[model samples]
Target: MASKVCVFTGSRSDFDRLYWICLEIQKTEGLELQLIAGNMHLSPEYGLTINAIRETGLHVDAEVDMLVSSATSVGTAKTVGLGTLSLAETFNRLQPDIILVLGDRFELLSVASACTCMTIPMAHIGGGQTTEGAMDEQIRHMVTKASHLHFVANEMFGQRLKNMGEEVWRVFITGSPSIDSLMRTPKITTEDLSKELGLDLARPTALVAYHPATLDPLNLEAHTNQFIEALSQFEGQLVLTYPNGDPGSEYIIKSFQKLDAAHGDRSVLIPTLGITRFVSALLHVDFMIGNSSSALIEAPTFNLPAVNVGDRQKGRLASSNVISCAQDSASILRAMQEAMALGKSPCGKPYGDGKASPSIVSALKSTLEKRTRQQLLTKKFSIPGEDK
Candidate 1:
């Protein structure tokens, strides 16, 4: 019998990163792919991205509807509580051999918590990366401690897992699967993408894919206005995406709406653009303006210039393609100038070599063949000086 591997996705962001690995799991012999989508994917407020998953020729084994409609911190806390409740029941019914989850989203904590109580093994992708500016810093580490297997983008991240007591044998330095999706997917022609987006991309354009700094308690509106003001000064067409469903994203959305109303023809605002279209935009746009991980992880592959505003992605690895700036009109405008001048040059790839899917698949297959669930689930605490 094939090893049944279930992948959990909570939002379009993580789904995009997981897309290629899911494809690899499906095609490889002796492996079965199961998918569970919940939270923002089920919420129409976030573009109902579960449809995007289904449209990708992947099957959804289960759907967990657990997001609370409230937009406050308590709402986020409740979403996690509800996710754990629903996923606990889902696990009871599905009985997957192992679970796969990615990134630092709080929803993954819900998935990890359920798997831990059930004694199911988990393989966590994007482990060991840091985002000091957001609550993800804490959630990512929490999931890392719970996961049985680790697939990280770089050696630095791989080592961090070891420091956290994960045996070296369990942590695999398989570059980010996001790179695989970015490089392998066929390009959407600029004209077709422009038509789909209803924007004339033939002219100079910048893409804004920012998300809220979930840890930042103050200046949500002030920080948002700073970036909008800077973008308004840009001499090119602007494409803005709605923030992900984080606590203070409401502020970001309202600010974007005002900018849209003011800028009219010069700006195009979208709720969500699935992976393909988003990557296509990166391929053609002059530069990116945001703190989304894609700016640090995927844009480097395209040699794309990205202006990373504020602290949302403060400590993560970035390449020359990224111009880091403060969340102020003057600082953002200065970085935009630097971004425009860079103009699509070669950027370093700190994430991986754009072929992480096969390595991850091979690791999963090897672990499945050689290790039992009990063996995989057994923990080994490494005292750095003592382990060696």
Candidate 2:
């Protein structure tokens, strides 16, 4: 019988990055794929991304609804607790041989904790990367410590995992699976983009996908207001996507509504653009303005200039195309001006060459074959300077 591999997707963004890996697992023999959908994907306020998953024809083995509607720190903490309780139940029922989790969301961390207690080995992706402006930085590290197998985006990240006492044999540098989607998906045309967004794509346009800085909770509103003020200086159409389901997201959403209302025809606000449409929009937009990881990781794939405002993406690796600035309006405007001045340019491949899914699948297969459940559960701490 094939080994059952359970994949957990908490948000649309995580699903997008993990889609190809799931597809590969489904096609490969001796691997039974079980998908557990939860968190923002189940919430209607977050674009009901579960439907998007269904449309892809992937079977969802279970659905765990644990997101709290409240956007406060206390609410987020409670949601994580609820998610852990619910996931424990789900794992008990599913009894998957291996659980695969991606990224550093609190929900994913909850799942990792449940898996660890359940004695179910987990495979984690996007480990060892830093996001200093948000709590995800710590969550990512915690997940890495819990996971038995690691698939990182780059060698530097893999080294970081090894430095954290993870055995070097278990860490694999698989680049980023999101870049695989960007390379394989066909670009959406200008006519189609213009028709869908109801904006003239002939002129200069900017795609904005900012999320709240979870670390700077007190200054969320102030930072968002400053960002909006900076965006007002731009002359072309501004297309904004809704923020992620983090604490203070409500404040960012309200700011986006106000910007849409104020700009009218000059700005468009979309609750969610999905992944394909988002990548297509990247191809058409003159530049990207936001602190979204996509701006730093995926935008450069299209040679798109991204004006990354605020410290939300503080410690991630970025290309020459990414222009970083403070949260203030004047600094953001200046950064945007600099990005526009660069115009269209070629970007170096700091992420990968768009082939991460296959590598991840291979690593999963090999690791499972090499280690039993008990062996994977028995982890030893490695000192930073210890000889191999």
Candidate 3:
């Protein structure tokens, strides 16, 4: 019988990050694919991105309701509780040989918890990455402890996982599968893309993808006003990607939409952009302004310049090609000017080889057979100066 591997994607953000791995698992012989969609993918508020997965010719194994529609932290906690219950039912029914989880989304915590209780080994990607501002920092480490196999985005991350006492042999530095899509993505002619969106291709363009700073107490409207005020000074077209479904997103989206409408040709609001279009836009745009992690990790690969504002993406991996600044209008404007100057400066891809999918699939096929699922299920703690 084929080994069943279940993969979980909670939102468009995480799915985009895991796109290549899902495709690779589908192509691997003797590996059955199961896609469990949940959270923002199921909500119209986030564009129902589960359809995007289906458009790729993949089937949804199970639809899990793991998101709290509200933005409060209390709502988030309740969502986790609900996710654990729903995911427990799903895993008990499927009983897959392994679970595939990516990144540090809270929904993933529930998945890992359910699979751990069912004695199913999980293979976690992006396990050791760090973005200090949000709850993801703690959640990523927790997932790493729960996972049996680790496919980290970079060597530094891989070593971080190993230092956490995970077996070295079980960890693979497979880079980031998300970067693989950039390699296969067809070039998108600016004229065609602009025609598709009815945008003027000749205008100087900036792509903005800011998200909420969980640590910031100011209202979303207040924060967005500063960014919008700064953008009003620019003489170019602005392509704004809506923020992730965090506490302050609704307000941010409202502010961005209102501003975009007022600016007319000067701005456009895009709910979401496909991987191809996003990377393509990065290639053609004069500069990127955002706090989205992609601006730091993926854009630099295309030699794209980014104007990263605020603490949402603070302490995350980035290239010198990115200019960081405070949230005020003057600071943001200065950063954008610098970013426009830096333009596309050649920088090493901070994530990994575009071959991450193949390496990850190879590791799973070879390592799964030899791994001790029972040993993985049994949690052991180490004392000082003691070796396992």
Candidate 4:
């Protein structure tokens, strides 16, 4: 019998990262692929990416409707609650041998919690990493403890899992599966992107992809406006990608759209771009100004300079090519100026060498065929006289 593995993708961001791993699972004999689409995937506002997955010639085993309609943390929490409730039913029906989840989105946490209750062993990716500005830090670690197999992006993350008392044998340092998309797919050329989007490739360009810091929403508009003001002063073309489905995302999207409409030939705003086009655009651009992790991890491989503004991505890895700045007009502009002048930072290779998918698949096949959960869940206690 094939070992059944169910993967959850709630947003375009996570889907892009998990695409290669899902393909790997599908190709493995005796490994059944189940995709559960929820949250933003169902939302028409964020491109309704479920169809995109189907377009790839893959089957979606289950569809869970769990996006809370409102735009607040309370609404996000409600979405999590609903995801858990719906996923319980889905899992009960599928009875998957393993549940695969990636990253630290609130929706991923709900799936992890539900799987924990059902005693379905979870294989988690991208844990043992930190993004202190967002609440993802808490959700990521919570899922880490509940997981049976961990595929972290780097050695540091694997060590962190060990420090947390997780069995070293259960953790695998597989780097990031996201980079696999770059390796497998053909690179998009500047001419192709320009023709597709009617963007002028000759102009000095700024590619912006930003998201809200869930921890602090008070200065959302203020910070957004500051970045806009700085970008407005630039004498070049600008392309902006909409933010993720967080509380303050709507405001960011509106601001970008407004700027595009007002700035006519100089600026273009897209709600979302496909992976190939996005990565290609990143390569063709002069500088990336945003807090998106793609700027941190993927851009470096292209030798692109990234100006990461604000705290949304507080505690993540960045190459020397990346410049950090506050969410203020002067600070952002200063960083942008530096980014335009600085040379490409050598690829750190800290996140992995784009071989994450195979490593993950090999481990999963071995674990699933074993058909028995390892007794790696031992707890440590302070023994008497252990302290010197």
Whole-model lDDT per candidate: 0.89, 0.90, 0.81, 0.83
Q: In angstroms, how far off is 65's CA in candidate 1?
A: 0.3
Tell me the tens digit of each residue's lDDT in model 4 across 163-273: 776766678988888788777767777888887777887678878888888887898889889988988887778888888888888888888888888886887788788
lDDT of 1 by residue, 239-275 (tens): 8999888888888888888888988787888999777
- Of the pair 1 and 4, which is ahead by TM-score? 1
Off by over 4 Å in 3: 218-221, 379-388
* Best candidate according to TM-score: 2
Runs with alpha carbons beyond 4 Å of true place in candidate 1: none
Candidate 1 Cα lDDT to native: 0.89
Candidate 2: tens digits of C-alpha lDDT, residues 30-53: 889999999999999999999999
Model 2 scores what on Cα lDDT? 0.90
Name every residue pair that clashes in candidate 1: none
| Each model's total of backbone clashes | 0, 0, 0, 0
Provide the TM-score for each candidate, comma-separated.
0.97, 0.98, 0.94, 0.95
Model 3, span 1-388: residue lDDT tens:
6788898999887787677787888888889888899988988777888899888787898998778888767777888889999999998888888999888877888988887777888989887777776767889899989888889888888878777877777789888877887777787898888876667757779988988776664655676789889988887889888877767777788888888888976777888886777878888888889777888877877888888888777777788888889888999999988887787878877888688888998898887666566755555543324566
